[model samples]
Target: MEQRVDRVEQRQDRLEDIVATMGELLIETREMVVEMRRENRQTRRIWIAIARKQELFDDDEFQDVFGDE
Candidate 1:
């Protein structure tokens, strides 16, 4: 009976350790997702800037009507 209790206690301790590790991993995953969202936002801003500049290039009347302005 004592040996059985000891085995159960050891298993409970190991389970607690696994739970702690899973919690840490969850926190890390959340942080990584937040960082990726931030990077995606920055990338979208750059794309918008590029598209605006492209519109200017596509507008030939922009130069003919407002030359060197």
Candidate 2:
């Protein structure tokens, strides 16, 4: 009976550790996704600015392609 209780307690402790680790991973994954989205937005803005500077499209055409900034 004592051995069974010890085994159960050990398992409970291990499960707690695994849950904590998973929570940390979930938070880290969310942060990474946020950072990636921010970087993508910045990259898109830079490309649009370059295209406009190079006059890749006329005003109306640019509007049609990219919409209003």
Candidate 3:
């Protein structure tokens, strides 16, 4: 009976350790997801700016910038 109790206690300790590790992993994953989202927004803004610049350069007033057709 005493040996059985000791085994149960050990199992509980192991489970507690696993839960703590999982919690830490979850927090890290959440932070990584947030960072990725921020990077995606920054990338989109850069692309939009580049597209606008391209449009400006395509206008008739800026045609000389590209030389003959």
**Maximum-TM-score candidate:** 2
**Residue 11 in model 3: shift from native, Å?**
0.6
Q: Which pairs of residues collide in candidate 1?
A: none
User: Candidate 3 has what TM-score?
Assistant: 0.77
Candidate 1: lDDT over CA atoms?
A: 0.80
- Model 2 ranges off by over 4 Å: none
Per-model lDDT:
0.80, 0.94, 0.80
TM-scores of the models, in the order given: 0.77, 0.82, 0.77
Q: Please provide, for model 1 over 1-69, each residue's C-alpha lDDT reduced to its tens digit, 9 standing for 90 to 100.
A: 999999999999999999999999999999999999999989866765675577755456655644444
Ranking by lDDT: 2, 1, 3
**Native-to-model Cα distance after best TM-score fit, residue 11 in candidate 1, in Å:** 0.7
Which has the better TM-score: candidate 2, or candidate 3?
Answer: 2
lDDT of 3 by residue, 1-69 (tens): 999999999999999999999999999999999999999989867765675577866556444544332
Residue-level lDDT of model 2, residues 1-69, one tens digit each, is 999999999999999999999999999999999999999999989988999899999999889878887
Between which residue pairs do clashes occur in model 3? none
Per-residue error for 24 in candidate 3, Å, reads: 0.3
